[model samples]
Target: MLSVHTSPLHQPGTGDAGGMNVYMVQLSRALAELGVEVDLFTRCRGEARPRWADLGPGIRLRHLEAGPRAPLPKEDMPALVVPFSLALLKEERRYDLVHSHYWLSGQAGRIAAVGWRVPLVHTAHTLARVKNAALADGDTPEPPSRIRGEHQVVGSADRLIANSGDEARALRELYGADAGRTEIVRPGVDLRTFVPGRGRAAARAALGLPVDAFVPLYAGRIQPLKGPDVMVRAVAELLREAPELRRRTIVPVVGGNSGAGPRGDAWELARELGVSDVLRHFPPVPPAELARWYRAADVLMVPSRSESFGLVALEAQACGTPVLASAVGGLPTAVRDGLTGMLVHGNDPVEYARWLRWFAEHPQAGAVMGRAAVGHARSMSWQTAAARTLDVYRDVLCAERSGPGMNEAGATARSCLADASLLEGREGRNSTLAALLS
Candidate 1:
């Protein structure tokens, strides 16, 4: 697995990290349980750390030195593609298939797959074309370079993995991706970690939140696309409409700022909208602790202008917390409207504010929705998602073994993957991984 630009080791809901980090970490662990060895490679951005480390029983994180040991903007990544691809080439020989997480890695993965004669699978966590179409206020449109890069990756990859049917359709319509190679694999949530019935009272006490407050939680990277400012504006609107609830209401916006959000900033927006008195800002917490926050919430607010998939909505639902999300991208699929949560259309603060007011008034209806949410979340799990993903990998490998897909170098890739399934009990050091780490 390639995750260039951002590392899975980084905390989600901060900086350049978000759902993709969680997706890679949770999916890798789930895949490991199914007896698949996963070596996730990303650009090294820190000093004093080894190039590779065993994350767990079957998962390893390998950092390749492609540039300076510091974070770089997404725009600067294009220049590092050759160096990143060269770094990947050193270890590409040992991999059966290359699965890249984002467009930056797709640049490297495409080169490595060709050099190693392995199948390449690319998952664009967010597409430039899709995002540019729904730019938030004071947000810049995605550059033409990124759109071109995505087109190249879409055309070059053996398989294009989309997190939702919505994403699959976008791939076809926006990038002209081959329908035959497109696969829809829903991103999974950690069921065991985000279990239901943690109790709202207990959660509030543990998290130091007001016990009587009607708390609406906004959790994720506080970016314009994520609409944290929209969340703030909605909270202000709700408070203004119902001043009586102001003393008993709290809007906890949890996450670090990024992109246009860093410039138009949520904290500044909250103050400008006169919601600072009722709003609480906190850094992103760990997953286990985040589940507690979800439990304590009257509802989770996802006002994202664009989302490829709504991982947090599922997470909040898994914690028996109803969500009020913008009906854009995968939010419609993540939330079962009138069942688990309410899906508001457009990026309007007024609509979201109306829903928040409704939840505050109808406590019984909110509880009923929360219970239904838990039931829906139970039916989806990381294990199930991993199993389905493994099926995709196996199908590709099997197709290659039988079909006339191999041409000289393809024979080597076929042999490597066909025998990999038999390596469940085996363990060894790969020279490339060892050298890079050392």
Candidate 2:
């Protein structure tokens, strides 16, 4: 597994907690379960030498030094690719294939693939086009150049692994990637960690939340795109409609700091709206604590304007908590409308308030939904996701060795290019890389 300069396996909560971290950690473990030796290569964030640590018996984390030892934000990552690619090439001879995640990693992966003659596989967790549209005040979207670069990577990669069918459609429409080369692999959740049977009252008591009050929880980054403000308004509306509902509190348990600008403004907005007394905000808690919070919540609200895959929804469902999410991006795929949870229209406070009231009024229906949520969550597991990812790797490797018109080394090289391209872009450069690999 190749990540640009960061690995959730090594530093789980360093930056904005996104789905890619979940994907890397869980998928690598799953691959190991299938008797595959997995080595995750990522940049060292601090002043650390390139070293290897055992994540498990079969899984290892290899830190590579590239560019600065200090941490850089995701936006600044593209500039580090040339150096990272050079460092990656130096170590490329050891691996059979490299699977790259995110565009910056794909850029480095592409260079390394061509330089070292290895197979590259890529997965883009989120697309710039999708994200740019959902940007909030003070949040900067990826520039057009970066988006174009992503197009190149996708077009060039040997195989494109999309987290949802929606992303696949985007790939086809935006990057023109052939349907045959793209694989749909959903991100998985840890069922054991997020089990439904956990005691909500006990969990709430542990967190110092009032056990008698209905707790509405929103977990993840407190960014504008995530629409935490929408949640605040929704809760306010719920309280306004039924003044007695003040007994219930809405908790927005943010997973990461929202920097200095927009996040501060969001706080100000809460105060202005008069829900400051009810809104609870905090830095991301540990995974164990997060699970407890999920279990404790009467309902988990994910009002993100956009999401590649709703991992939070899955986690909440696993804890037998229903979710109220925006019906956009990969959210609808994870959240079954009226089944696991209710799906509301885009960040509309009125619609959200309606759902909140519906959940609050129909306690039996909510309980039924929670039970069904647990059952649905039980069917999807990190282990299953890992196995499927391993299958994708195996398929790429097999195709490299035995597919028509390519020798073992040549096929391997082609696969690597494909993987790298998946990280970079899906257009021109990616197509050129694919043609060269072929």
- Best-matching candidate per lDDT: 1
CA lDDT, every model vs. true structure: 0.83, 0.75
Best by TM-score: 1
Clashes of each: 0, 24
The lDDT, on a scale of 0 to 1, for candidate 1 is: 0.83
Ten contiguous residues minimizing lDDT sum, candidate 1? 429-438
Candidate 2 Cα outliers beyond 4 Å, as residue runs: 10-14, 47-50, 258-264, 403-438
- Residues 1-438 of candidate 2: C-alpha lDDT, one tens digit per residue: 788756665323235556678778878887788788888788877745547788887988877877677767766777667666656655634777778888877776666666555566789888889888777666678798778778767865667888889889988887787787788887888876788654777887788888777778888876777887788888888888887887675565656644323353557777887888877776676667788888888899999888888898998998989999999888887888989899987678878988888887887788899999988888888887777777777777776667662233335554555554444443544455344423
Per-residue lDDT of model 1, residues 307-333, tens digit only: 989899999999999999989888888
lDDT for residue 381 in candidate 1, whole number 0-100: 88
